[model samples]
Target: MSHTDPDRYVTRLFRDDYPILQGLVASGRLRRAAVSLPGWDKATVFEPLVPVSAHGDHHLRLGYADLGAQIYALPSAPYAAVLRASGDYRQPAGIAGLQVCFGAPDLDAATFRAELRASLAQPLKLDSTPHLATADHGGCHATWWPNRTLILESGGDWFLALAFNLETRVIRSPGKSVFGIDLNADPALCIADSAGVARMIGPRHALLDGLRREHLDRPLAPKEVRVVRALGYASGRGPLEVALRDMLSRAEAVGVEKLDTRQLYARFVERSREQAALDWHVSWLPQALYRARIRLHRVDPAFSTQACHRHPSHLGIVRGRMFDCPLCTELQHRDKNAARNIQARTLAVHRHPR
Candidate 1:
């Protein structure tokens, strides 16, 4: 078991699959998938990676034993991208390669390493936990599991890591039924359930949800909103994380299962170059949900908006704004009703494929 090789090499990790995943997203092959959890609404697929939108320029708060630790952000593009891509996972699957080996080239190598150099830095105290300090900048700690994020030095002037998190890895589902979520740029997101109830957690409430609950802030100014949204497009905040967090927190108070919404969109649409970032959320949200121990689902997105659950009629064009069933007149929110119809269609096609 302790055998050593003169030459060692590692293959790609799941997050490495991100580029392909990103392509899948652009092609509309990937959609949010959901499997319900008992005490909460359905958890979308595991998206352990935090979208770059929320954490870009955010510091990494590190700790050792009980000594003080400091938060730092690496300036290298690949490092940031790898971290952004896998950040939400239970652990950061390590990254290793020749170009990014040892350290980021753009960074002052000595300065960057000095932070982790031990001799050059002072340790800070951790004073807050559960309830501590002010909400504005008060924070929690992140621990490292052996699950993902292991980097090493290669002998021939190279460094490499296989970045992936085992703790948050995707697994077969244990749920009985599926829930579908159809997305709209209007309200942001929607959810539909089996009992014919549709719900939504729109943008306004989502913004108020804040990065952390204890330290809520006033509404984001218009400019700030654009930046955050754009990050989701470029790096990502994995939009559903906040939405699910807000909904599940309320569901906890009511002692009801929190529902999750699966994102469904069309592949047949035109893409504007400026809107490329719009696709970032899809690749990362599931990993974020996985860290939260939630599940996400995806269904065939075609006509999810027009087709009514009560009838097979494409009753109205662009009919997803409000849920109005022409046959029985069963009214629902456009997104909510669409979610129900999506769930029905996805289940009919593949009944909980492993």
Candidate 2:
């Protein structure tokens, strides 16, 4: 058993349109109560569904005999209509959801707490945060295979595998892969290594920007403006996902641990001060990295133009966006070089540990 799992896995089940077994939690009879499977006659129990992996790409397997049959018979369905996905916020732009058209049972609040005093080795920590997106509540039915443990939940049109597990460990990359990135600089995103080798990340904002111009350009009435705003809201998250996926693929290939970039927080602050209305140039890369278990670091991004890798001591002349030193031979793009220096600064800061 992995450390992420408990001695005996216990999955939480919430009853739909019913009191949450309040008597059990209040009576001090049980530390936590296992919910009753609706339409269950208290004979055969809900099938025990357990989560195998913790952080990245989790999967559910039934703790039963007919695993093959269960996998072949999961209630999955497709969307009824096709939307352009150009400007939809309620629906996922790139992510897909599992939907159950018909095969789930209604849940009930009726439950009996197990006298699990012997099951305790340590005090159990319960997370109170309610499931925001999909809850195993409401009138949406769920399927519980033989033996109560996990439930196949239905939320209106969406189907979800609602498994109860002891704990899950976050997946992480092995070690540090130090790289520098300059956002909104010459090549948009430039990742450079310690060997002075550099690579540019594609899937630039050009396509999205073109769509914004074509669909969201100004000089229009209320409806067009709404359409454009919706489009931006819908498609805005895609570029960051692309960049993050690209970064992850590269980082994994080279075992990247720390990604150093300019502190976008400060940039956003400065931009907000400059503009009357607030405009946020937020990147979901950091959040994505966090989810992917990658480390993120930042450095003062002002020195890229003033210095080059070849000679950190000598300041170079900035020509528009490029930087060059007359005394030294080669020339470097300001942002490109800055990208390298950013990584250097981060590594130096980390090594010194002031």
Candidate 3:
């Protein structure tokens, strides 16, 4: 058996507990729990039919055989309808969930639906059975195939999070390409691969700025403003995902600048304070990197833009969009240069592991 860092591999199973389970937790009978799934590589959390509160609900956990099946299941019928009904659904102005429809564009609906129904049958059986795994303290059981083990703890109420513990060793990438990314306040992502190819995902600040302007004069609720920015991020994600997928098709790892929010906000003020609000919309970039299964390295951002990638001692003049390096033959896009520098630094760190 491959050993896992218990802390890292521990996936949360439920969010809020049912009243009976909550009572058990309150009475000190149960506090925390752990489960062991020997061969499963993926899992899913479904919102229960009823919720404890608007915010807190008991969610169910089920193991998936693979990612394709999981994606096929997520956008099916009721779930798809709910996603479409969301204010942010399919909106370019929302968060990263704008992809209302999951799976391939031309996925065979009839075949996928049939397969989804068959796959769900076993787990859905638990709805009526409601089996408990019988830990040292009481714990809910998950209906998964192959093998299962459940353990318990005596801590206070857990966070309302459903985590899926994936064994890191299970998902192995054959590619050896490394990529470095630079995220700009323009709400754009510039990627530089080891092969020297560089591409920009989006200069999405305009849409966010437009959103701010549209809502700036209104006396709307914070949710309304947030929804607009979320749509922007969601829309931005389409290009970002496309870029990442293309990069990862030949890459096993990715490197990104370790951003300092204080410096970012300060830079915003230097540019124009009016556009600073764009920061919130683009903040999803870091979260998006983590969502991928590939190896990730965060390189230091100090001097990433100012120093010349060709000659470390020579500083580069960073104008609005271009970098003029004294040692370089021609002008380079500031973000792309920064991305290349980030890639080089990441490679250095990996080669000489300190």
Indicate which candidate wins on lDDT.
3
| Comparing 1 and 3 on lDDT, the stronger one | 3
Model 1 residue 19 CA deviation (Å) reads 21
Per-model CA lDDT versus the true structure: 0.33, 0.34, 0.42
Candidate 2, which segments miss by more than 4 Å at Cα? 1-176, 185-187, 201-218, 229-239, 249-283
* Model 3 / residue 221 / CA error / Å: 5.1
For residues 151-224, write the lDDT of model 3, one tens digit per residue: 22223322222122222112234756778888775546678888888787665444335435544464335433
The best candidate by TM-score is 3
lDDT of 1 by residue, 1-354 (tens): 111211111211223233444443355443333432221232233222322111222222111111110111111122233334433322111111211322233434333223322321233222112111112110111222212322221221111122333222223234333445555554555655544566663333222223213223434434333323222222212234343333322221111112232222233112211122122224333433334344555545666667776675655344336656566555656666567777666555454456
Candidate 3 TM-score versus the reference: 0.49
Estimated TM-score for each candidate: 0.38, 0.40, 0.49
Model 2 lDDT, full chain set: 0.34
In candidate 1, residue 280 scores what lDDT?
20
**Candidate 1 similarity to native, TM-score:** 0.38
Every candidate's CA RMSD: 16.9, 19.5, 13.9
- Give every collision pair in model 3: 92-231, 93-230, 93-231, 93-232, 94-230, 94-231, 94-232, 95-230
The weakest ten consecutive residues by lDDT in model 1 span: 64-73
